[model samples]
Target: MRNKKTPKIFLASFFLFSFLPLMVFADSQAESRKFFIDSSYDVANREQILATNKKVSSKAYFYVENDWFNKLEDEDKITVEQTLNSLAQEFDEVIYPRLTEAFGPEWRPGIDNDYRITVLFHQMKEGYQGYFNNGNEYLKIQNPISNEREMVYLNTDALFSKNINSYLAHEFVHLITFNQKERLRGVIEEVWLNEARADYAPTLLGYDDEFQDSNLQQRAKTFLSHQNDSLTEWLGEEKDYGVVNIFTHYLVDHYGLRILADSLKSSKVGIPSINESLKKAGFSEDFSQIFDNWLIAVYLEDCSLNEKYCYKSPNLKKLKISPSLIFLPSTLKTQFSLNYSTTFWAGNWYRIVGQEGKLEVKFEGVPDVQFKVIYVLCQNHQECSVDLMPLDNSQKGNLSLDDFGKEWTSLTLIPSLQGKVSGFDGRENYFPFSITASITRENQEQEIIAQLRAEIAQLKA
Candidate 1:
């Protein structure tokens, strides 16, 4: 949802692709490693520089950009220098080994004299930047700066921010992405893809598991609260960017890192990349098919590739409702009485097909004896989440005999819906699913049967 309080700026709606030159530029032409200090960098900036140095110096092969050492006043310079030295010692002692373990020997210092990368401390818009060349790259950062005061603005004041580590860890993913460049070039534009991938890295690395977990809950709320006039309105939206992290984490957990690495290096396909990424992830369904499901789950349509659940469509069938299935629509009007026998029990799967519509279900008997009809509906493959959980509260399917207490139990699973809507336990849509019912009473046994039938009347209606 757009922040009504934040002044609306002319935000660009188009996605910009970073064109990696066919030939890597020579070192002389690459962006120079120069720092432009100003009032903006301030004391906070200097402190962060020293802090980052202490966090990275253990390997000792890399050195701080000490060119401007003498440029500052004697007093200011000494304090900065001392801080830097202290930070260097900390990195050598505490941080380097851990980083080595996380990235492996390939990231070990002095292992590659040909490529020496460096991280630069600078004021950015409250995030970190890691851009790579044939040789090395730099990391630009800002805590969270905003023109107006706000709690989470990424600027100088944000150094002590709760998610500082999250931002840093995210850029660390870019370092990982750099190492996997060959695998990413084919599936997405280099810049957008890398940023999106990095956005999810912190969660993958478990930098802030608890914080990320909480953020995922917030994402569902954000997705459902607003209505954008067009998909364009939702572009570059950041309220639930952390949700991308959760989703990317899900991918790495399920499909392995290779799929993500491959997607990053893949070529750009503009809007179609949404579908291309799904296909790469082994989804054969059309974009609309998956998006429609997402719309139902989150109450907002996600136009990004990462939001897709990455599943294959199930085997589909269309059965016309014969005279036998709907022989007596009026017969189903009465409440559960002597005529209502359990012909279909919970767990019996069925499908309701209609013109431009479909539904699937397992029979869930009426909870209230006063009610006349009950059926579980699984509308599409998106809601067919039995694999994630045996009973999905979010799924909609056809009426079946097998959906009594067991199916209702599935509705009580963890991660209940919060904020605006209730009982929306997961990230799927909520639409009332309809089904036809029938019954017959005989010998004191109410033989109640519900058929998986398509609406043939749509042909005649």
Candidate 2:
């Protein structure tokens, strides 16, 4: 996916998945099954693992690398199969008990023993190692090519306090959150809350002291510190260990896990579906409000210098006065750049162009003020120049010099398709607009909070 420019903000690359080649599957059942079995052994080990907790699918397939086969002894080959079976059962034991408790007894074990997880140990180039979607299954590759090996290395030196368990808890939650019927996977927002709720499952299962560790909270702390400018982009893979884990931690700490889990029971699976789950929670307040509250608290606490994880200062926070500040028509057509000017710093805006009908801005700043009042200045129907408006006498809609004097304020202005013009014809892809927000200090400019940018990518027919 390509990124568009907006405002005077700093640009960052958003990384999630590593691009890889697609693996084709055999149509013949016997061949597929043979592939699965051989893949699980070493030269010293052989034999297909027979699962105990769940019935093994008669047609399940296993895949193995030729190199492991070259080194294993005949006896060790048997051990490999036994090990696979043991790992499956052990994984289930560690996982199901927690899932069943959180999701309720009705939640059944893996649907259709037909689902299979492929194991691999390849000398991959120095980089990430983990599972990726492979057709109907997941490929768990062990990359020997990694230099850091922090995530993929199977090491005896690794620590396993409750904090680490939360990591495991989070990933396991992802596994459980999968819908076998639709073949859904990963931590999309709707499912994110589920995993977030599960993040506390370790504590519920009796691991409290570790939950209190300063190191454990690093995940949430990192996200809380950077919410404003780069979360969507900053939350790339390398930083996920903390961001995802911490979001999960926050979910449980503020909203009880049971409430969070109950919220997820009926929740949808992707970003948009998150609202469905939030609705199930029956909290009259919107999820954004709740998120803002949690975000504000986190940012303020994490910004402390004494804290292990401190957010760098000198960040620009942008707040939008409207759904979007419309820019003059751009038939330059293919691309547009967005920029923001703040007394504190110069920020950039994200370009809103294309058939994807929506614009989004993430307003980020230190938390201190109780509320914000916004003003959108634009020519009646045409785009108008927005003079930085002051926050004083905002209830009266007036501005003065006091507002432009501060140095730490930033507003991330975003736009969503509006009016009858939302998405009609090819025009539905975009609405031309340029916009920016003026920051005001309600209390003292201490809290740093960021409003996430969202563009409605789905179009109605």
Candidate 3:
């Protein structure tokens, strides 16, 4: 189900700041204090200075930009205060405990030496819901621009929205990820997997159980529009979130939360981390094999065919890909060919409506690149069957179906690049491939002979 109007997409930023020496603030119940803000999104000004008034809670501190707070009406200000207080309670009771239990903890006794996390609310650039900066976890001597605390920055505009809690859960995961993977393990987690965990945080916290207007619902809509986006590439775009959110949902739905938790705790990064976790869990399927199953699952989300072919989550039970390209074979046009390229782990679907004849398909791809070709054969009012089209050393494969038109009502070809297991640097590598299909009718012998005779008689005359 697609929303008619644009959704308030929750976008969070994870940025690393350079270490620089700066004055640090001591723990206090101060009325106001100056803080460093990231102004990279602001084109007109690049100043990183702001003053905020603090609201203290048992487990956290909420700071709102003084200028923005001053402009709001008295009643609106009261509402903002209530929202922050509620968020503080939720964080202490829900987000902190749940995430820490699952993926480990944020740097404990952090830079501030207090068990309190800081939440800063300011007018950020449009489209940004919030962000978590690891710089805040370092001392002033290590990072000059550091706030020397476990802090998260939220856009002032989101302070009043119901989705603010979800934003907090998302950013808080990044803080924990920084500690779990980078601080403890001394390795940077891949951006895609990092974001995937954050995107799944809402679901883990039961925020997405409502489905409507939930982050998961919005991501589902975004994914339907941009299904071709690569799962491993991290461009920090909305489409990137869509891909990671849904893919992560599918992963956790089947493999359980241990996949995420164990992978984060592992010393390895990205694909290797996930593979290591899978091996430890005693699952025979590796990352590549799971990816292939996921490709089919996205197309035909029917668990009846195979448990791996569908999402067990009720929210995503109906989610499936609708191929944009469709081929119709007829006597006038008996052959069709398509040439295109795709990034690694991207899903491409092509549907073919066969005519009454034998349908033949040949797929050719770059020899150096690994390709996985899967075809789903569906007959009217019958269960569909899925199988792989085996490619030889040359990365070429052929498929022939004699009952394509009569027995099989439709055929969908899903092709993906399974190469490049690790080290995805947000670069787009397009692997070009082509698929050619032709149909041969059973009664064509007499017609060809008569046509040839007519052509020969005419040529003699």
Candidate 4:
């Protein structure tokens, strides 16, 4: 039962509150976006403008500031121009329409008759690829950049050399959010959700960063390999861009991508806005409930096992992690719960020792729990054979484990989420769950039955 197995359960460690993929900032991440107020810094001294290039017909302007721009050949400029134009088309053709549908009529790109925003194709200090600030923040009361127009300070050196599409996609989402949220709700989006959505932009465009880099698998492996790890561990850590991306993707897959628009227009700012978005998107379950399903689906993603309860992560079928061995000291009884903040599929394997005749195992999940089941399968040694199935429905409450195969010396208890984690009202995400598992033998059952029979006989006499 203690043999090494490979399985990565994502739910065990749910620390994804600081959903990421942002730098510490070239100069104050907190201050980077408040451009209208912070004019003291001399951006001009760092790099002199070599040339101002324009297509006359196009709305976007490329202001070449660093010497690196002058160094590029004319052919390179054409490539940059094509890429920028393609992005602009993406904004007009797809992004704008979809976002407008989600946030409503007033939520759109640009404000004035020109409807043009600025992208400064200049040099930024190293380490930053590109950035979008509320260049229109001065008109904050009337909505963020529509009146003044948005400007993206580009790090041409970084952009030209790296994955330009992905870089642009990420920053563009930021610009969209600023305009949409400010225009509609008159408030900025919450930083975590705002930043998380920005990272999700690349994924939305079909560039799967998490799956491509195997970051989801790698991160899930960390949670599965270490027994002590939990969602609480990485709650606010900054290296969570991957975590946030997958989480957002899961939401889109389950409820359709409209959740983005619903989240933006809600008057409720941070988490509440997410809940509101879920509600608008016809999801009875909010962030917390969906998170519960996500935890189970991250590992148990096999649609063959249960389609209604699984994610569409095709790669997950090939990626199985080694389950951590749960150590039990006394009677091999333990009380545990599913309260982590992650939505990855994972479970624990417990070796049930010193038992033979009709061993009984019990599980008790949280009230209103939807996906709690106990699996009894052991696959390690040849001498031991107790390959059993789970014992419980998808709902909450105590379930009996009386059907474990006979003549099985070793047994493995796998507590996994068997159903979609949702609320009766379909609006809660954080559900408190616990299972108090205690084992009993046939002898104990017989003794209790005999005592009841004796009492009945005495009453008859």
Give TM-scores for every candidate, taking all chains together and pairing residue i with residue i: 0.37, 0.41, 0.90, 0.54
Cα RMSD to the true fold for all candidates: 16.9, 18.7, 6.0, 13.9
**Predicted candidate 1 versus true structure: per-residue lDDT over 55-105, tens digit per residue:** 233233222334333355688656655554553454355443443344322
Question: In candidate 1, what residue range of length 10 has the lowest lDDT sum?
Answer: 315-324
Give the Cα error of residue 297 in candidate 2, in Å: 0.7
Candidate lDDT scores, in order, read 0.31, 0.31, 0.80, 0.46
Q: Could you give me the TM-score of model 3 versus the true structure?
A: 0.90
Q: Tens-digit lDDT track for model 3 on 100-156?
A: 999888876665666778887877777678877766666565557777788887878
* Candidate 4 residue runs with Cα over 4 Å from true position: 1-51, 54-59, 73-82, 85-114, 122-128, 139-148, 161-163, 207-238, 313-461
Q: Which ten residues in a row have the lowest lDDT in candidate 2?
A: 148-157
> What are the clashing pairs of model 3?
20-144, 21-144
After TM-score superposition, the amount by which residue 289's alpha carbon in candidate 4 deviates from its true location, in angstroms, is 1.4
Best-matching candidate per lDDT: 3
